[model samples]
Target: MNQVVASAPGKLYIAGEYAVVEPGHPAILVAVDQFLTVKVSHSETVGTIHSSHYSNIPLQWRRENGKMIVDERENPFHYLLAAIDYTERYVKECKKELSIYHLGVESELDSSSGLKYGLGSSAAVTVATVRALLKYYDLDITDDLVFKLSVLAHLSVKSNGSFGDIAAATYTGWLAYSSFDREWVREKLNTHSITALIELDWPAFMVEQLSPPEELKLLIGWTGSPASTTSLVDQVRAKREAKEENYQFFLQESKSCVEKMIRAFRDKDLSAIQKEIRQNRLLLKNMSESTRVPIETSALQTLCDFAEQYNGAAKSSGAGGGDCGIALFDRKASLLDLVSKWEEHDITLLPLQVYTRS
Candidate 1:
């Protein structure tokens, strides 16, 4: 093939945010309409990446001793380079010759102001790039492979993450996801065994596809301030590691709230959904106060409070220093009124819908 194009949707965690980092814990995620797209075409010269998200100048890279290398100054695109490197390594392990290709990546996952909405844009781009390269090389492009390769590439760039974003990007639509064994993966990564990692039985990591409840309205409101998930997660982790009693209590409560929310969703019980959403928000709020991690900012808390006045539910979606907060409502709720109230606080209502596999 002369060219290949692939895209992956961004994700939002409805519940079970920081707790999902623990192995065996579960989280509910939904793929949003926003997507990161990657286009790969054959190139005669060195491989380059063209992305408006990065720079006007196309970043050039080359292979040295079977490893991909880019100029030190162009480290912004390291995630893209890491995806290419991991895919190449997988191809080599299979004893197959993969042709080089130029990659063009573009994303609609950010706000008009160029601030990310914390919609897992990095994971989306990583998954899209891996899929594009696999298609370009005529390799197998199963969702399983996409998830694993994306996780590997993601870990290559950022040392620690739950990789729930990779799972959501790989499998579109609403999903109930259980955490994978990060410790096992860490051991394999420490040994630099890409082949072994690829051959592992990863299907044990559960991802059950689901659908949104009927008449349930979902809305995302951007706080106009971006949050660094890595930093927030690290802060939460440190607080937890310090054996904070309140932190432990928050984890248990949050986990139970997520379970109830998932059950309510599956049963299509709107009242139960609203109740659990409020419970989850309260748990997060208490955790924020105890840990001092700012899981819910004053702006997000006000939004949630306003949403509750209409019998709707709202809370911070991800790591939540700022970024976006998600609100869910029944058919009777007036979205226009909610939007107007949010606008008064300078919050922008994002035009996001649930994304599903075609």
Candidate 2:
């Protein structure tokens, strides 16, 4: 009997987000402090994995709307089948069969706020699944191929994604990936290289010593309004089609801003970093669609107003309108002062992290 324990973390894009959705858009993503872990061990049965956390979740191979259906709710049997099929394929490829297995998933992050920051929980699951399956079957899977397969599995789960999450989770460090058409390239950087980048991962790219830790803070203001990502992405696409020139201008400017941001990181220029963040957010605010919800209700306007008051910068995280928005402060700003000001609101101020993933 063999078993494997594997985990994949969530990712955050400090710069590129909506632009990544456009064709040929290059972006960088860092695996963040969140993740889902899956453990697979050999068991007696050929089918059926007992999943304790989620409801009747199953993975299967079948036809849905004329397409191969990999999973559907209540498909525990399907997950077992998927594990067997994947394991058998790996074994055959390796010219060996290590036998049957049992698998369970435990993603550390909670949905307590039901807040799906949309960092790739499913992609993390896919990464863990393939790794556990291959390890259990006694085969070596390359990280590149693992990433490719993970992306395929992700598309199988949801077709609209750009694969940013898969890229960040598969590789153990910060990644510079073009998610739109799946163009990926990675640069290894030790935590010292970008004092802001911190984590418990490989540090083989730059300076050997780590930068002194600084207390990072974020002031999050919730508008209590949320919107649909599908509709928002569609809206952006529509606007771009109608106003190609203006949109292209923003794209070029945003790309320049991102490049400068990368340089600011390398130079340790905090002011430059803040400048780029503000510039990029401005371009996105005017060019992109409304935060999916009208700014009035979405708190998009309110957050904007607050950012001005605090002398900081703010930007929406996900498809917009609601969910969460990130408010980046100048490194010298007082975190406690910001917190005291925000204490009366329902908003949550989370400790911020800038890290190269492992």
Candidate 3:
């Protein structure tokens, strides 16, 4: 067995969503500090998987009797590994003998339980894992390969992904991505401008890899627990499919909001960011009656209510309906006070920074 290492970035969704799947809409994202690390250690025939791909998948599986069978009937690892293989063209290009060397893989970073913030953690892992395998085999992989492989891996794994997080994390900065190209285009953004706006009077927040820049007064709140993002997404898709409604408005508004958010980043205008997210909430709500379907369980409503009281702004961060939400505030923000409230609601608070890693 050969030892090979691979890594991928965590993600933050700035804007552009379900709409981006179409041809023109652009999805915006910023890589977060967290990451996924895969260490592909080879063995003569030793192969076992340890993962948190989903809540129920067991820890171990194997290939035997000329078939890739698993101990668990429902483990998605085989599917996950298949996506990687497809993305990296592993089965297509590798010699049959080398292919038997199952990767003793590990997804070092799991999804954040604190909030169902729809960052591209899953896709990032896929990209990194495939990248590691390609590197291990001395194969030349391109950015396009990474991006496409990531999408395939993610959609295959979760069926309810938007690819925004993966694109942002993979590029390690603000990015403008389109599903059409199946690639992430990196854009170097000046975070100082955005941070400065967020700071104005109080201490400024720094954007860097997964580390909190400093103690500040930023508030985080949630309502509903994490739910199947796919469910809500499917709802939206179904509505569009029936022609009962049009997402054009949602698409246009989301694109517009993201465009504004990027400016806010450049301008460091907390107010603008806040306002944009608020608009995003309304649009998402309109897309589907998510607010009625136990939005309270997500604590999304509670957080927004809290933010409103403090003259701050809040909205779901990832795919809405569950998981996590993002809150933005100026001098009016207070994280400490919110912690007790969030704790009372049993919601975890994770303070995250924009990715500044090179």
Candidate 4:
């Protein structure tokens, strides 16, 4: 192959954050227009990796008996490296010869300052890298296989996240997701071959593409403060252990709310969808109060309040702390009024639209 390019969209959680960590719990997510793209080109002597997210200079690597050797100082591509390793391993098992290639990545998922907008850039990059490499090798690429490979590769780097972001990146649209049992996957990884593992049905994993009501419009607002999702999740986990009863109550309520929202989406009931969004926000607030995790920071609270003032339903997206908040409004609602209110509070309205994979 001369050069193959692949891209994956960033994701935002529509609802169900901490509660979705548990296996079989449901969450809503949407893939945004912002994307990370990877390009792979054939190489002869050495394979070079360049990333716009990193320094302008490229990192050079050579194969020594089928092993990649790179300078330690220029090794910021942990997720990319993992994706290459796993995909190459799968290729070897499928009786394909490995080849050297130059990999380059460029992303629009973050700010000019390289600050993340909590748009699941890591997941998008992993999916994009795998897709590009698979195409470069002239192997068949399917969304299901890409998702499975990305999950395996991502877990090898960071195992704390629920991997819902991976699903959104791979599927690329509005999604209703239930997390698979990671413990089961980890155990299976030790016992089964890569080919066998991808063929098997993962326990409790469910992903369904959703159709948003045509009358509803989704909006996103940035608080300008980046949040560590892993950190917030850890704090909530510690609190869950301490107050098991309250945590369980929150989980049950969240599952119920997400289910209703899913139904609302299917029925095209804009009213019910907005109602569930409000209920979901209050549930998250209660969880924050009980856990003391500060999921909804002051800036995020301001963003949500402004949406409510404009007759919309809003709440913090993902693990909160201070990233982005999402709101749902009727098509006829005055978006300018909401934007004006948000600007007064120094909240930036992001120009993001839902992206669906063709």
Candidate 5:
């Protein structure tokens, strides 16, 4: 049997975290070299799904009257199952016959101990599955369509995510992204056909490619603590509901800061980029203080402090609390100084590079 393989890279946020949760707010992100790969092949009878990240034994399922039926309790494959079901629906919408398939996944986004690195694994896996299946079934695949399909499947499983990770996985590179109004998409999903939905213009959704300054060097460090982005976002949202004015202030300020950063990237100005990084870090700090959500854990603070002490600009990479922090410095700077300081605090330097589909 012939199998088609496809992969999607993970991502890290450079700036605009909590604010990006709101519709139309911009954030900077980059795709990392780590990837989740999916392999899809034809199956005449029972469809089997296997994942290196989820289970040692392969999960089995079959279609019933064209609907996928798997144990709902097998939560580890929830995202994968959702991706398959939605992609099949899209195939059926295109007047194609549904067929059984064996799908398997291999992932490098997590450590051997299964510790997540906050590298957007869910989005990467979903994208990889969709891409592999689309190729296996001989369908036309575009980055935008793959992104929309991935977003649709992801939203079906979890509704609150900004889906910026989906965009980052779909378009592998540095990006300035503004989230689409998910509420609008959710309302439309109930009434529109999947084909029509994919074709419609999503309001406030924008993805622009960016080029980093040649002199800029990015550094990533893991604090050896995993953070739940979903939970952190929920906590921040719960707290911010009571302080609407302050939340709005944060959103506006983040928008301005990210826009300037985007311009700096476009202009290839390393100094301006570092300045905006510093400003964005302060904005996140203020937001965390007001919301009482520890966006920056003590370990992450140490990581950033060491970077700053070594003449670099730094901040937490994602929803913070734990996971990883990122720093940027001029290529001419001595990284050994910051490395030694980070070592004193048990911070592990991650050897990750920007991933682009050349």
Candidate 6:
């Protein structure tokens, strides 16, 4: 039996959360060491998806009339199914076919106790599944193809997303990314099929490689609570649509702060990076207030305050009602002291680092 295995890393947003959804606004993201893995093996009769994280019972699926059908009751692998469907569509567009297979999907992106760490698990799983299926069929898969398929599959499931996580999973390192035009995507979705969307000239979505300074120390602390990113993003989007002026101001300020941080990264200016981190945190706080969305929870605020006392910078990494907050410090700063402070606040330190693709 032919088998193929592939994995993709989860992501953390360093800067530009709500604002990055706007077309052309840039956000910095880092792919973390944690990854979701997918294994594909040839199946003689039927397709099945097995995940230890979800259950012992394997979910059966089949492709009929060029569409995927799966048992939807208590199904937890919709993203995987969606990815496979999208990849199959792409392959069909290229005048090809994918063989029947049994897929095993799993992840190490969550806490030991099964709490989600707000690390782009769905995006990583989608990317990994797409890569595994393409490799299993001996199809040539480029990074651009992986990204587009992953985004298409994700959008089919959620309908609204920025896809920074998809970019991070595909690129597999630190990246400075500009948002693709959401309006353009919606229009294309209305008029085109998934295969046709892949062939279209995508709008100005840009991603650039970036590196943190050598003297910088990165730490992630889990707040033991999960935030509903979809709910938070939807609330903010509705508010922005209603009050354009306030959201526009937030976007401009966030863009400015992100630009400063990028410049600091290019110049290797630690002080400037620290300053921008603080400014970005404040901008998010103001945005939370204006949108009436709890982007930063009390626990995250306390985490930032503790980091500030040690002259380090900290903020909620993603949509930020709760989950994980990242802290940045100089090499000379005492990690022991900071960890102790976090422990006192009952926050758990997540031992994660940036992952680079080989």
User: What C-alpha lDDT values do all the predictions have?
Assistant: 0.82, 0.55, 0.56, 0.91, 0.91, 0.86
Steric clash count of candidate 5: 0
* lDDT per residue as tens, model 1, 1-358: 5788999999998888887777666778899898999999987659888998777788887776766678887668877778888888888887887665688998998877688889998898899999998888888878988888888887777646678888899998988887788667767777866778777875337788866678888888888889999999888888776656877687677778877877887898878887887787788777777678898988887778778787788889988999889888887666788789999998888899989988
Regions of model 5 farther than 4 Å from truth: none
Task: Quote each prediction's TM-score.
Answer: 0.94, 0.72, 0.72, 0.98, 0.98, 0.95
TM-score of 3: 0.72
Flag regions of model 2 displaced more than 4 Å: 50-53, 56-92, 96-99, 113-115, 172-175, 180-231, 289-297, 300-308, 351-358
**What is the TM-score (0 to 1) of candidate 5?**
0.98
- The lowest-lDDT stretch of 10 consecutive residues in candidate 3 is 202-211
Q: For residues 1-358, write the lDDT of model 2, one tens digit per residue.
A: 6568877776555556666665545455556666677787654535334444354553324333323344455464333344344434445555674444556777654346555554556667777787777676666766655665564444433446556666677774445555533222123222122111112132211111112113323444544554555566666766566677877776777667876766765565666666776776676676654323232233555564566577776666555656556666766775565555554454555443444443
Predictions: Cα RMSD each: 1.9, 8.6, 10.0, 1.1, 1.0, 1.7
Candidate 1: TM-score?
Answer: 0.94
Ranking by TM-score: 5, 4, 6, 1, 2, 3
Please say which candidate is ahead in lDDT: 3 or 4: 4
Candidate 6: tens digits of C-alpha lDDT, residues 140-170: 9888889989888877787466789899999
For 306-353, candidate 5 gives per-residue lDDT tens digits of 999988999999899999999999999988978988988999999999
Per-model tally of clashing residue pairs: 0, 12, 25, 0, 0, 0
